[model samples]
Target: MPHLNLTRALTAGVLTLVASQALAHGDVAPQAVDTTGLPAIEGDWLTENPYRAEKVGEETWQRAIEIGASGYNQNCARCHGLEVVSGGLAPDLRFLEAEEYGDEWYVERFREGYTQNGITKMPAFGELLGQEAAWAIRTYIEARPDEGALDDFAEELKAMRDQMEGYIADASGADTEALKTRLTEISAQIETASGAPVADSVAYRAANLIDGSAEAFKSASEVLTIGLSAAH
Candidate 1:
């Protein structure tokens, strides 16, 4: 619950501090994140992530995470790594807390960016993406499962994915409800490094996609396949 506490040092260090010179941040142009389904946010920027499930309801929060995943992968993944995990080139943002303190550091860096030795390591994203995208990305960042949070359930999840794959081939005997229930249980057990109440892990995502339909099973199976592959 502490420096998984990036409050103080982060404000003065973290992304603002030194990094590898070989870092490749790619295009200077920020990618456009489509936040069509999310609620529009305007005016002054918020200090806290307004899209958290508590503030905006679970439905909106989930939507924000979905939209935010796209934004982060496109704009922040090169240095920050996918799912907010860092590769030593940039700060690992997953542990940044979900409170006002962490939010302040994040908003500042995200808006002002950082530079060292005349190189633009982090580009100012506030203008290009706007508030909705910012908060959506924030939501996704805080919802990331902690490193190895799924390790305990890996084998079970793999077996479940295989079962779901079978259901995809033929859904006549699919125990879709059971699959969704088990996935939801696994998701609940996974913890977010940011200390957010819930994590938007693969199990949570796939569980939501499951609805006792062939298309739903296929979609869930694909999510599991990709997420598991990425985990390793």
Candidate 2:
């Protein structure tokens, strides 16, 4: 698989998506999202996402995040903002609650879209993208870490990223397991703005990239570089 090239932990000023904006997303053309590897949704649109960890276990849940990130970047990023961080142009979707109510609200907009006074600000995505892509995108939107989620650890993380670079050059003394464990622990501590179980932050991505190889360290280091750089 090609690299996901996660654009994460952005120091966004606002939300994952907006609720009601006259010029929000209604005008943009909906893009087709590739939902391959994701479990399909059946029997009409779902009121809740089936990709949550508890519903389909961690493996599928993680896949949903991956696929959703791609789908979101392709389809929703224009109005929703890159990395789900609204730049005051649209409502931040990160705060959208992650329960039945939020799910219903998101599905409604995603399916039917929003418009006002004869102008189409958001287009209906139900027919084109299907319920699977809808929920996959939702999975990603809700998993965004709260704004400033990485501020506390930014410098420390930068140091680790630099250390990982050294490991790439000389893999002799690298304690790869310890690095993964530390990153995992940091990932667990981060909180999502939407109250989802996981934040899918840079730490989480970095930890998953480690495999005791130079290439793995290089990839993980790049993930940190992009994520940390965006935080500021």
Candidate 3:
């Protein structure tokens, strides 16, 4: 009788544990995100986001953000929290700025996910959902308001301006027209905005120019990289 009772108790315990695990994750299957009507991203996967307003136009970016918000709610909100807010279970994604610095980590995690003690903490979403959905979700997360984002933007703008000036001064035969135009536009936008919360349009434009220019100007790119890490 004693051995029989112990066996029954162990079976009940296993059932309880299974129930709790199911409740924790809600659904084990990956939620589908509708990426219909979004621009196609070529190749297997992009290391960086290609949905910035500057890269794909404001209209397309708006569409991406809408799809991304819905996708995030369905897939990421359970662990990452609604609107990119974290409730201590996962890292707050709002702090992941919309740049290469954040992109590297986000892409890696989304593709491979995390595991501990042979248990899967985050299941890999790359195979189930393609790059378009991933980039769209990233766009939405980056759009969320963060505490220090504006201050970081201001500092970065100043550094980019200074770097552009240096680049102009040291130019030999490179076509600096595009770089000069971008720098001028960014400086004017920064000067016009006079508060902590910079306007979204201004911020987006500045970030686009800074990111786009990084390929041509190595020094400025380094500064932007360093600035992004510091901001995070």
- Which candidate number has the best TM-score? 1
TM per model?
0.91, 0.89, 0.54
Candidate No. with top lDDT:
1
- Rank by lDDT, highest first: 1, 2, 3
* Worst lDDT 10-window in candidate 1: 8-17
**CA RMSD of each candidate after superposition:** 2.3, 7.0, 16.1
lDDT of 1 by residue, 1-232 (tens): 3664585435434444464557545345698889998988777888888899988899999899989999999889887887787776777788788888889888887887776677777899999899899889989999999889988988998999899888876899998889999999999999998889999889999999999888998998899888888888
lDDT by residue for model 3 (1-232), tens:
3333224433443344344443233235678899997998878778888887778887788788789989899889986777565555555666554557567778887888765446666778888888999999987777664445446356656665556545544545444566556544553343211121222333344344443343445555454554445445
CA lDDT of each candidate? 0.84, 0.82, 0.61
As for TM-score, the candidate ahead, 1 or 3, is 1
Q: RMSD, model 1, all Cα superposed?
A: 2.3
Q: List, residue by residue over 1-232, the lDDT tens digit for candidate 2.
A: 1111111221231222333343566667788888888887779778988889999988898988998998899878887789988766565778777787778878998889765566666789999999888998999999999889999988889998999999998788899999999999999988998889898899999999998899999999999999998878
| Clash count per candidate | 1, 13, 0
Q: In model 1, which regions exceed 4 Å deviation?
A: 7-19, 24-27
Stretches of model 3 off by over 4 angstroms after superposition: 1-28, 148-232
